[model samples]
Target chain A: MQHPVSEGVLQRPLEFTLDFFGVGEHHLRAMPLSSPTAVINAAAASTNRIKLSTAVTVLSTDDPIRVFQQLATASALAPGRIELVAGRGSSTITFPLFDYDERDYDMLYASKLALLMAVNTDESPTFDGPHRNRPLRDLTIVPRPEEPLKIWLGTGGSPNSVHRAAELGLPMFLGILGGTPEYWARYGHVYRDAWAQAGHPAEKADIAVAVHGFVAESGDRARATYLDYEHRMMADGAAELGRPVPARTDRAAALGAGGMVFVGDPNEIADRILHLHGLLGHTRQILQMDVGGMPQRDFLRGIELLGTKVLPQIRAELGTP
Target chain B: MQHPVSEGVLQRPLEFTLDFFGVGEHHLRAMPLSSPTAVINAAAASTNRIKLSTAVTVLSTDDPIRVFQQLATASALAPGRIELVAGRGSSTITFPLFDYDERDYDMLYASKLALLMAVNTDESPTFDGPHRNRPLRDLTIVPRPEEPLKIWLGTGGSPNSVHRAAELGLPMFLGILGGTPEYWARYGHVYRDAWAQAGHPAEKADIAVAVHGFVAESGDRARATYLDYEHRMMADGAAELGRPVPARTDRAAALGAGGMVFVGDPNEIADRILHLHGLLGHTRQILQMDVGGMPQRDFLRGIELLGTKVLPQIRAELGTP
Candidate 1:
């Protein structure tokens, strides 16, 4: 994978080698990795075992049929290894750029999500919605996957979004940028409760969490490195988007077990992950290690530590494969 | 490359090995290779030397910025090796499927083509057109290509399209499905005349030709093989699209030197290609060897002959690299 650290922003390749432990996904945030399907498809050509996905494919501004076709084509290259996480993007940049109105954000997301799911499951799907200029009657989105794509509803802590995912019987992916692990666990309960209310099986209600953090050889290095980069990332991102710089979180408090940021050595990080897993009962946890132009070596060392140190401890303690 | 013959329609990979001689492209017809950028990106991951392209991306129904981003992303995978051929598609399947009205076909193409060109050159572009829900004011399409993508104006012999390409200073890709070399040569003259009249340098007026063809060990074998599949393809496509089967062209006449089809042995095919080149002065010639349900072996053999025999002969005779 040609990492963004090598090519600069907006050209980052999603490194799916993390699929050895779990799936690796790239989200469309600000100006980076905007063409997630294209990057995943390119990565699909070379990697065999890794599962790749779009963490959040800004669904509101995109054509569902086009997204379905791109993912389906990528699946052809790497069968059974493609997944999609559709979200009303956290960033509103796409609405203006794609000629959509921000006022219709939720409405657009709901309409497009229905169409995306319909196209995934039906060979000839008929759908009518405000999102489309005209109703699609029995249109076949071509290059259907041999297996239907596994779609996750991505949300940034919206109760309505969680309920919609449950109602639709999709996996819920939580994008947790801030808040304590205990605080974030409430969304998982809400999702599962809604899933059951919607008459879905208990086993089917899956939840995944993504957080901003890093791991290093020592707790001191990890905390210091992550704090420096995370703060810079917030400021740089805000500046890039012409938004006000966000207030920085307390470094010591955030790195504590009560907070969401997961920076620490392998042992400490593993313990925190397990604690969060117990509270949320989530299916997966992804760490955003590289932020704010962090050097490749530091980011890679974090992944190495997560894989070689963190995962084994978590698996051993959980008594799972 | 995960050829569709190996998987099945709409799942075909655009084979780019032809770039040893020139670029390889896939066109979106009724249902085959519809997501060209995804396939190209996947192919780009494995191949180093082959130039990949969408011969005719149905630009009328697609968002130009999205198309640009997808192609730009693919270009990052294989820098300086991605090309886009934009056309008002020959098939009308996409319009209804994408919720586009066929009444605005030419208008949509012209508007989108302008935006595509604008984004390719300018980092921030402003535009207004009937095609857009709202006018774009200086929107920066993300991940601009390191090098501007080679955009070819694809036309199935439309005079207005030829003029547009010339006036825009873009290369013209003539999709010559059927026409005698002598007759098709007029388009080249027209394109060059307009290009020069529009004040573009003479050498920059490039013309590329794509035609239905097949090459076998013998002229009789090639003609019979291509005819059988071509007939089946035409009938199948018509039935699939619910259009009337097109009137069959005279087989002998089509296979003859004065005809467009280039079916024959390598020696005969080479001679015919040279004959066409003499008339058209085209920079690139791509043969559509696989049609209908032609076996993979036949397609591979045709490509093998084109690379090993036809290209070598043509290159030697032309005395140009």
Candidate 2:
């Protein structure tokens, strides 16, 4: 049983990013892990405190009942520590891969999210979604979690996604690829306002941020090291999506103060997190440290610095015990 | 990560039994495990040599693509050690729970099995099964295994199941709940004959057996301990199925030579296994030791005896290294 220190994940851990963005080839080359919930179950067996989630489950292409069942079983292994971050996926590859029509994306996500929420809340739920041939009439989903699982709506900051998440009273997990703290903060405010308007408690309208990042002994080293890997990832990813690759200068700009990428030294990364927290007021901020098949030594070092150096500084700044 | 020795599974392991036979209540009470492939992934993280499989993955109601993906991920965790035993589930509860008609059982299993086999063989399979709304035209499945997975057709000795398994050229996993060696051997021969008629190689026509069993220091003590639990399991299971409970006299008869339940001392269990092997010519035999909410201590001890005492005897009798 490897610890997050030995494996991955620092504090409030979110691991095993599942996506359809060149997932068949490039991502497979980048990481050995596959099938998020199953991987989390294995991680659940080893860890005691770190919250495990399927970073972003492509909920649009997956069966929500099976997802719930898998997560519920993982929760049994590590009770009260399992979570789910579902997304309608940024890539269109999954629809055809899973035999789903791309045209039904919105309907698919909406209906599946509804079913997932229903199954999460009730063991015996009757769902008549378009995905199913017949209505499930009070069918029991076994091995219910000890408590209701914390489900987050993972979004790339589309207005519909934010409003839908808020309306459903689900927490928001903002995935920031390239955007300033101020830019992301607007979505947070919109989500909270919509959540309150939808009659959900203000306290329950929680938010978390996910971003591309790395940390090293110095800011220059961190940025320099992450630059090539991030560029390669972007180039390969763009090619997969049949889009023009962004220039290295644009990638570098994303690592700047007004940018989204959070690469820097420990102190710099900590300050960046604090700044984001002040703007977004998010409870958690998880970094994608090992993007584009970065070396394990660098990735592990980044995680070590984040946990030991960066997180403590953020906690101190936030007045958290 | 817990080894099979520490957690469960003495030699060849089949942990995490997923069945909807009163699964919502009774089975949850009996086992902490749920969702076979997910649990197997957790087990895969720890063990290397001991093979892990989802003991009879209820295939009829499940999405074969998802199952393949999950199993393939586990294969990544423990390459060449992950296998799948897909069964058209004995219980009918999964059908309603997963939003499928029980009337479509034959069609569902047959079609899903076809898709699973195709995905196992080809990474980009074009499947147009009845279960799917549209055809998957050479859609690529990610993280292909280094080798094609060993898929066994799990059955309770139905003629149709036997023929289907043989016709598909899949290995047979005969599940013996209550049948004599001679009675079960007839199905093995039928399967082998069909395999030959189907033009499959004789060497590749492998068969494995599963039975309710326990091992103890003495034959009387083994039977005495297993009797109440097996009877209780049968009673609860029968009640779940809306069938009359088998009499204790009948269960006791099953523990005897001419019956299916293999319960006795190490020597007694070994002899029974050998006798059955001689009749059936199976490659492997797995026991359902912990049945009817049996105590962990007893189950653990049974596994210990099986690994240390019984397996050695079988090996010696078979003259294997």
Candidate 3:
């Protein structure tokens, strides 16, 4: 899953400078805010609390050492609040931009992930890899963060990805369009089983699922409002991934039990959340309310409904309140 | 002359993040915060006004297109408040890190600077340069800024450097250790002459000067407080560049007429500023108060003195509000 969040923060650190100047006073800015970590560093200056993470940093086409340094620097600014979710991004623009061949995706991701892990684990690492400029010896990355960061493996239903996360004992995050929660929940089980078989503690296995959805005051309103966006999204958005946009007549069935679309009012959405919880036992759930040129007012209303209505009901039903 | 001010800004975008956090209630932290542009991007979120710039981005070992994007992104965030001062940094570490040889420094800098200008000017560019991975064609950078940025050329004292800045028709900035103002002023004359010869408007030529200085209540106290730090800085910092630090006995003499060091009471420092202005005719002057690891309280005091006492006198003398 090319997480929209990670890409935004990674690519648009300079975006915040407007806030610094326009919003209030005494705001600081960074100069070269091109990379994600750099955005985090600049964020450190503007805020006191709030955990920062990349939704999914594309590991296949990036330099692991530099990536580690970037995250480490942010750690220095805001200790214990930095996390990284690594995956192959939704787009392939980075491959040619960074001078990498798309064919090497598998080997590149694995090798870069290994290097990132090594850099985090050891102060001085000596590695002979296809990507290294030279063998490093006892080299140290500076402005050392006060604490180690948590790394989450981001995947989009690839079986191989689940095994890789399990083998690494990394936390897992599933990103996708809304689909069969019951079947998708099985991927979590796969991760858990592999993690347990790999000798990791059973309790360490965790999963987070993010899907496209919206919350509204009424079930009908939610469906009607989201239908148009869903239609456009499925038609053009999924076209690149080879997923056919289904017939509009099937929308109702798709929102039923074990369906992909999650359009409904607070109660219906809460019920769906509970259903997914019961099936998958996911630790966290995220909803993407804005997509395919969503209007700002509708998006804001959806957010308000989710926060003030749906979430409270979900919490109470899940026995978490 | 790699202006120390630009170098400091380019290299330490991370340090400023602390200010963003510690000074306020609603702020954020970044993960990598490694690059100057990223810091600027994050800064955009926190502020609205105040021109942000890279003191010196070391263009020789960096990618100009990416650099332009970094600055451009900040421009989008902060609008007309973005500036770039480009220079070759004082360190040689980037040569090996970026896979460039020392021998190609001159050619690499010229080529890269030209590429940066091209990307800023045209939406699509095709080039066959020695450093490009491939010829770029019909590409558009995202978040196009509101206005063109102001780019300044930072130089220390190299004759060739002066000619390059003049030929490029970019504003010139002089960075130096305490040097004779009358002697140093000659570089400005040379730049103007070269700029005129290059057919640039005479009124467009501009110069800014920066040097080491400290302001206190008295000359004796200033000398006493800054001596040990100066002694250590000269000995260690000079050694890195293969120069010998001056003797302790020469401190007072160095602060006299035709001197580099600017240590004195606020009135005295103010007098020196006007003195340099008279000789060098610099439009702007920047003083470095903290260097060689001086205590924070002392550095803060020096800044306070510069603001409260030195600046008032200097402004009054110069007849500027």
Residue A179 error, candidate 1, Å: 1.2
Q: Write one digit per residue (lDDT tens) for candidate 2, span A126-184.
A: 78888777787645576688898888898998999999999999989888887788988
List each candidate's DockQ score. 0.51, 0.42, 0.21
Worst 10 residues of 3 chain B by lDDT: B18-27
TM-score for model 1? Answer: 0.93
lDDT of each: 0.78, 0.76, 0.63
Error at A160, model 1, angstroms: 0.9
Model 3 alpha-carbon drift over 4 Å, by segment: A1-43, A121-124, A230-257, A317-321, B1-34, B46-48, B96-104, B230-254, B319-321
lDDT string for model 2 (B1-321, tens) is: 122322444323222221111111112223434488777766666555667777788889888888887878777767787889989887786776677889999999999999999989987788889988788764567567789888999998889999999999999988788878899888889989999999999999999888888888888977887878877876776665456877776577799999899999988899999999988899888888878878777777777777778877887899975
Candidate 3 lDDT tens digits, A268-301 = 8888888888887877776767655577567667
Count backbone overlaps in model 2: 1
lDDT of 1 at B109: 96
Ranking the candidates on lDDT from highest down gives: 1, 2, 3
Query: Candidate 2 has which clashing residue pairs, if any?
Result: A1-B1
The per-residue C-alpha lDDT of model 3 at residue A173 equals 78
**Ranking 1 against 2 by TM-score, winner:** 1
Off by over 4 Å in 1: A1-17, A20-30, A249-251, B1-17, B20-31, B247-249
lDDT digits (tens) for residues B120-235 of candidate 3: 77645565566665655444433345665677777778899899999999887777765578778788889989999999999899887767778778778877767567667656
Question: Worst lDDT window (10 residues) for model 2 chain B?
Answer: B17-26
